[model samples]
Target: MLFVNLPVSDLARSTAFYEALGLSKNPQFSDETASCMVLSDTIFVMLLTHAKWRTFTSRPIAPATTSEVMLALSCESRAAVDAMVDAAATFGGTADVNPAQDLGFMFNRHLADPDGHVWEAMWMDMSGGGASA
Candidate 1:
């Protein structure tokens, strides 16, 4: 199972932002300080408040304005990638955080959530997956 944990300033706002991107909340693992967003059957994203996040990490949390990591998600089609970017903007996310790229076999865009966490929406032609990098 894959899990991505992010520190959020506001749990409610962050949860809503992810929901706008089509991930559902998993009530079984949600509470005041944290909420689990199911990305897939085996993938989950845990949004935790800074206070709660500290319990798991000794390092100071990175300010939202300064990105520490970029979360990338693959879409089934170019249109799906576009739609996710649009939804991110509509839900108070900052769009175009990174320049859009189209590589014939791949296309991608970046969106920043309310707390400034970067989420990348990408689409890659599977036929090229086996090609040498």
Candidate 2:
């Protein structure tokens, strides 16, 4: 129900970061000035310059370097999550120091993107969802 647009200093760098996550840019909404990253069939991320991005938001910005929120996405299988994490590493991302924990029905791996944005790649078993953690 919500489409998020993030502000970045460089459009090319931001595009590369999302591409490393296996997402493609929507050319229809993208141009040299901005990039519209396709997150899902309906979800989109419009990466805009700070000046243009402020037009859509009035609140103070959260610096990606110090912010604590790590965008998370669910994967269909454990291997898929691992692959994403591995790809991130291959694209100059850093894997979280801790390995993914297997609580019987859930698996997760965390990695930091090139811009220091943290993302969690996870998979949950529909059977239980691992109530404990």
Candidate 3:
């Protein structure tokens, strides 16, 4: 299983933002200072409050304006990628942080959550020759 941990200034608001993007909170691993959001059977996102995050590391937290990483997720179809971007914008996220990419066999859109965590929703046609591109 893959777990992505992120620090947030507001736990409740961040939780809501991810939930809006189709992640369900797994209460079994959630608490007042943290929430485990399930994206799939093998993927989970751990949302941690600033205070809770400090327990794990003493490094200064990066402000929302800076980015540490950009995570990408595969979608079932090109339309799904578009839907994900639209949903992000409707729920406190910035859509199209980067220009949309379309290369015949692959399509992708970028979005940033309320805390400025970047994500790319992508669809690719692996069966086609474009997979090499």
Best by TM-score: 3
Q: Write candidate 3's Cα lDDT for 1-133 as tens digits.
A: 9999999988999999999889999999999999999999999999999999999999988888887899999999999999999999999999999999998889999999999999999999988678566
Among residues 3 or more apart in sequence or in different chains, the pairs in candidate 3 whose N, CA or C atoms overlap within 3 Å are: none
Regarding lDDT, does 1 or 2 come out ahead?
1
lDDT of 2 at 59: 80
Clashes of each: 0, 0, 0
TM-score of each: 0.93, 0.79, 0.95
Q: What lDDT tens digits, residue by residue, belong to model 2 across residues 1-133?
A: 4466677777788789789877889899888777898878877777787778788779866775665566778899999988988888887767763467777688898887655667788889887546664
1 or 3, greater by TM-score:
3
Best by lDDT: 3
lDDT (0-100) at residue 11 of candidate 3? 94
Write the residue-wise lDDT of candidate 1 on 45-97 in tens digits: 99999999999999998877898999899999999999999999999998989
User: Candidate 3 — worst ten consecutive residues by lDDT sum?
Assistant: 124-133
The 0-to-1 C-alpha lDDT of every candidate, in the order given, reads 0.92, 0.77, 0.94
Off by over 4 Å in 2: 97-99, 128-133
lDDT of 2 at 32: 74
